[model samples]
Target: MSFKNYAFYDKIMLSKPVTVKGLTFISVVGITIQAYGKYGVFLWSTITPKALIVVDSSGDISFYQISNDTATSELLESITLLFAEE
Candidate 1:
């Protein structure tokens, strides 16, 4: 998926989302990819959009797109991260 322009804290409504193990995966939220060699990607956001993204050390990604106001979801590719290259 490509990077999308979204307003901070504004949630996105997805019609179709990827389902993994009976769980709907969505929220392809763009993160500020911090470049650090050995440590891998570092993400530190004070405030972000409603959709949440969890990334592990192995570059493994888990998308939690459900918004706080209303539950939500979206579709995403395997370990595909979209953001500004730092």
Candidate 2:
């Protein structure tokens, strides 16, 4: 028996997460999203610049922005989200 034989030593811990697909999201107001899956809709936020993204059955995607609590479609390639303070 040795220290290197410990069960915890068998696995390597990652300093950060690794994501090959979907998107990582975070925002102010204590919201943190690790991953967004494929298909269906992505409910962004209810605050300023409220946004929504819908993915159809065939993989067609759409982006929408909210104004006066109404959602309006927009053309977007990608979007960025803020991270919480460490």
Candidate 3:
């Protein structure tokens, strides 16, 4: 077999998803979002500045400062820092 075939076979062997320690963040401005997930219908619109939006699996649109936080204080602090710059 060629190198390409060997690589494909290796990927197929590890098709399961694994959890890695990390965080994910998405930022967008002046754009609308439509989210469809296992929860419900969620929508968001950002026509202003400092718009932090999060759409979960339940389809809920909420305005938040920080994206991922371990505690409420952390979230608040992040949000505070976020708008503090702009």
Query: Which numbered prediction scores highest in TM-score against the true structure?
Result: 2
Candidate 2 off by > 4 Å: 1-49, 68-86
Model 1: lDDT equals 0.41
**Which model scores highest in lDDT?**
1
**Model 3: per-residue lDDT, tens digit, 1-86?**
21211111110011122223332223322223344334444444333223344555555655554323134454445556656766
Weakest ten-residue segment in model 3 by summed lDDT = 5-14
Compose the digit string of candidate 1's lDDT tens values, residues 1-86.
33434333332222335655555544443333333334344333332345555445455667565446434423233222222221
Give RMSD (Å) of candidate 2 vs. truth: 18.9
For residue 43, model 3's alpha carbon misses the true position, in angstroms, by: 29
Ranking by TM-score: 2, 1, 3
The local lDDT score (0 to 100) that residue 44 gets in candidate 3 is 40
Worst 10 residues of 2 by lDDT: 5-14
Residue by residue across 1-86, what tens digits does model 2's lDDT show?
21221121111111232223553222212122232334443433222334444555455655445334332311121222112211
On lDDT, who's better, 2 or 3? Answer: 3
* Alpha-carbon runs more than 4 Å astray in model 1: 1-48, 68-86
Clashing pairs in 1: 26-74
- Alpha-carbon deviation at 42 in model 1, angstroms: 39
